[model samples]
Target: YGAAEAGRDYNTTDMSRQRMYNEYLPPYKAAVEAGVGSVMSSFNDINGIPATANKWLMTDLLRKQWNFLGFVATDYTAINELSAHGLGDDKKVSELALNAGIDMDMVGEIFLRNLAQNIKEGTVKQADVDQACRRVLEAKYRLGLFQDPYHGVSEARAKQVLMQPAFVQAARDVARRSLVLLKNDNQTLPLKNTANIAVIGPLADRPLDMLGNWSGAGDAKQAVSILQGIKNVGGATIRVTYAHGANVTEDAQLIARLNEHGGQLDIDPRPADAQIAEAVAAAQKAEVVVAVVGESQGMTGEAASRADIGLPGRQLDLLKALKATGKPLVVVLC
Candidate 1:
């Protein structure tokens, strides 16, 4: 229902129908079989047609063949992207999407602006539009939105649910179990309580980075940093040190793009060499070094992609320096 290339937003996915069914289509089919209320079309094209305007995918496969009873929605601004994908202008593509069996458009007003004109000009059938509207309305009715639009939403409820102790503990427990120990040479993990530990890298103390992408309504201030987690768990017996090794990236343009929502990147103003030197100093004092690294929260979500998806900026340099310190190293990726 979401994304086309392994859920990396706005990324392209090109594959044949056989490949789709063999791999990518199963999850969507499973969602349909599970009676998901609605399905959002992926941003990528299936075969040649955009998923939003692919009749074979949206209508033939999803509705007729798979028997998906739910309404189909387009991903954010996806209908508008049809023109960019060399399909057509807003008006033409909007009609194509509707005729293709898309019931709802997300964050693009193309349908609202052009559908009526399309109908009057005989370009779009009114019955098709009516059918799409009917499906959307039926979904709302099924969700009881017509009876109570404000169901389960209140300022009091928000306060009660957000960061509740039980919820936080449950989240922690799930995260603990999800961790995979890929390799552990010399039994390096489960560090001794007596050892001096140093936690380094920009992400080590970054609470906002811990919330990750698509963390809706979740406060960054309430999130705990890895450094804090280590300190909290290590207790009085264990010795711990911390230093931020480098900013996530030093590319001014990327930082500007990431901070468009206002300082989301959290770029440090310190010189990269100075940051790495501080981290090296910290590494020297500890028996073991835990280097926390990787993308900022903004680096992987919607509209964000990379030509080279390696460690950003001087992070790899910092890692190299930590390795040179001759201390046992643990790299924790965000």
Candidate 2:
């Protein structure tokens, strides 16, 4: 729920606000109403306010107005976010979180460690502590965890529910509904069957990164790559040539981290000159150069905020080289 970047893909403030109200809020409200026990808020500061301790999201949205009786948990160590989130120091953050009605402090023992001192110092009201603890106890009572703590999950069930086909199909349905066709220019309609088609780009050939960021439920193995899609669109006679024009990122830190995680995008962190030369050569020979350009999977997701989101490294240089080749350039902006 961070603010949309200025002048980028989803940069408008009004668009961002609309997403919060129309997209993210309703499901949460529904979950609370379905007799759900509790909700754990986020670690990242949303709209410059930590969701864990935001008065608007926690007090106004969940408690006072929604009348949610369920307990609220903080995302791991999010209670001590005062120091990291620029709220204040650890002590102030603890007080803020407790007062904000967070019941459980995950990972960070801020409340257990400092609630007493905060009460003595008049930074936190004792009534706030009682209310939070009461909510937690109420949740435990509702779950019957006190009488039967380990009743729901079992090893047999865990193995059997590796992946329920019904669940997978439901997810696919949601994805299909959310799908937006970016371009469908006149009678480019269903692209007539052609024997010669160029499947050229960094992503066109790489299936792994096609799933994009935070693909937790997405089956990477099952998801078809662009190359697979093109092949599926035609028969054996259709010819396809793939060229890895440029890497996903040129940042040294990002490349090192990606390499550490066994990522394919950071294949070779050599100078941009070598990759550009190779792409230029391939583009020069082909009838069309479908150049792929953009950040890596983790580049724009969590902790991936950027002061400048301009094309990474010498990709522009590579594109310029490819353009000089005079082939029909069909850039795939990822």
Best by TM-score: 1
Q: How many backbone clashes does candidate 1 have?
A: 0
lDDT of 2 by residue, 34-128 (tens): 87788887766557667777788788889887888888988767787657767887788888888777888998998889999999999899888
Q: What is the TM-score of each candidate against the true structure?
A: 0.90, 0.69
Model 1 over residues 39-66: C-alpha lDDT tens digits?
8887787656788989998999999999
Give lDDT: candidate 2, residue 295.
Answer: 65
RMSD of each predicted structure: 2.5, 5.3
